[model samples]
Target: MNAYRAKPLRYPWPPVLYAAAMLAAVSLGRLAPISVAQSQGLIPWLAGGALIVVAVSLDIWAMKTLIERQTAVLPHRCSSHLVTCGPFRYTRNPTYLGYTIMMVGFGLIMLNPWFFILASASVALTTAFAIRNEELHLLSRFGFEFERYCRATSRWI
Candidate 1:
């Protein structure tokens, strides 16, 4: 799995693709004949924003558990742990899970199908990329331990 090992990513592709899809969905929704009420401005937005924050907190907690479990820990960007506890036991990437939940919350706040679609796309793409990169790193680092974890826990929940 050396070929798939995590390395410097092609930066803009992931961000650009995700942004473009999100924007396009939003643009289409706006252009189409839909009577969207502009009145729902603050409350829903606040609620959704709160949800996003909670998700992020959960992610932080999960990551912390992984950090505690790993022999050598690093910062977020350089984390080398193959965490399989906490929320990670349910979904391989709780960080991504937080992002997904946040996106959904944002969609609810926006009350726009476009935002929802974008959130979905973002989750799907991020999950694919994360799994690929993380798998390679885990295979290289933890070997059988990582494999056992993978067998026990799902990639996503």
Candidate 2:
């Protein structure tokens, strides 16, 4: 019998980390504001709005796919099945991608340089703390099927 179980992540949830990062960025920006542009223009508004929409749509699609497949949505839980349809076809980590995109969108909308800087840091932390363990667990559980999916799909898009 397989003895391995997907262990809960030692770190906080990715969303929490993202939120903290955003907060920190905002605080830092207020203390030392670095202007990206002279004015809050229409271009930033349109671009940011479009990005937010895409991020939300991707997240919903990914979550729905996971639910339909009867797999765990939270990273801490073990996946019951390998999901390869919907947004999963494009990115192995669609949810994380969504989070990152959302952060970027907010950064643009807020015109905060610190948001862009900390967004990169947030991705790095998430990858190190979350994705590494998830990949290992999925490999241990799903074996070659997960490997094939990894080969076919990008981690982020």
Candidate 3:
């Protein structure tokens, strides 16, 4: 094998599926025990929304810190420099973590357990795919440096 596989389909189906699952869970939860509406009208929603924003912003920060400076996949070849600092210190894929967190936060805000579960699944799947791609690229580009970094950092934190 080439250390990495071909890129999978880029459709947003995974995220969509997660969203659906979350909605279903939340709806069921609300129906079974207590509805979020009865508890607090707009409070949890606002908090959840804020959490989502924060999570997305963190991902953006990770993107800026790691990928933005190193690689240029837009114009031509996928030439990305190895990024191993800041958020990368804790987790190999902070951007993906942030993405997952953001989705999970949204699900929580909706008071939908299903959404949260879906978000979690999406994270797991995305991580599996992204790590494979990233590690291969890193191994090819940075060689020992990337491998060393990978050894040091956890994949998710």
Ranking by TM-score: 2, 3, 1
**Candidate 3 C-alpha RMSD relative to the actual structure:** 4.6
Per-residue lDDT tens digits for candidate 2, residues 61-104, read: 99999999999888878788889999999999999999889888
Query: What does candidate 2 score on TM?
Result: 0.92
Q: Candidate 3 regions off by >4 Å?
A: 1-43, 72-77
Q: What does candidate 1 score on TM? A: 0.67
Candidate 2 Cα misplacement greater than 4 A, ranges: 1-4, 8-12
Each candidate: what lDDT? 0.65, 0.85, 0.63
The CA lDDT at 153 in model 3 is 90
Q: Candidates' TM-scores?
A: 0.67, 0.92, 0.68
Model 2 error, position 112 (Å): 0.5
Candidate numbers sorted by lDDT from highest down:
2, 1, 3
Q: Give me the candidate number with maximum TM-score.
A: 2
Write the residue-wise lDDT of candidate 1 on 1-157 in tens digits: 3643443233424445555665666687779624556655588788788988987897788757876887222221334666776777787666666666766676667676666767777778765765566566667767898889888887767
Across 32-133, the per-residue lDDT of candidate 3 in tens digits comes to 644344436777688778888877787677767745567532211344566677687888777666667776677657665556666767777765654566
Residue range with the least summed lDDT across 10 consecutive positions in model 3:
3-12
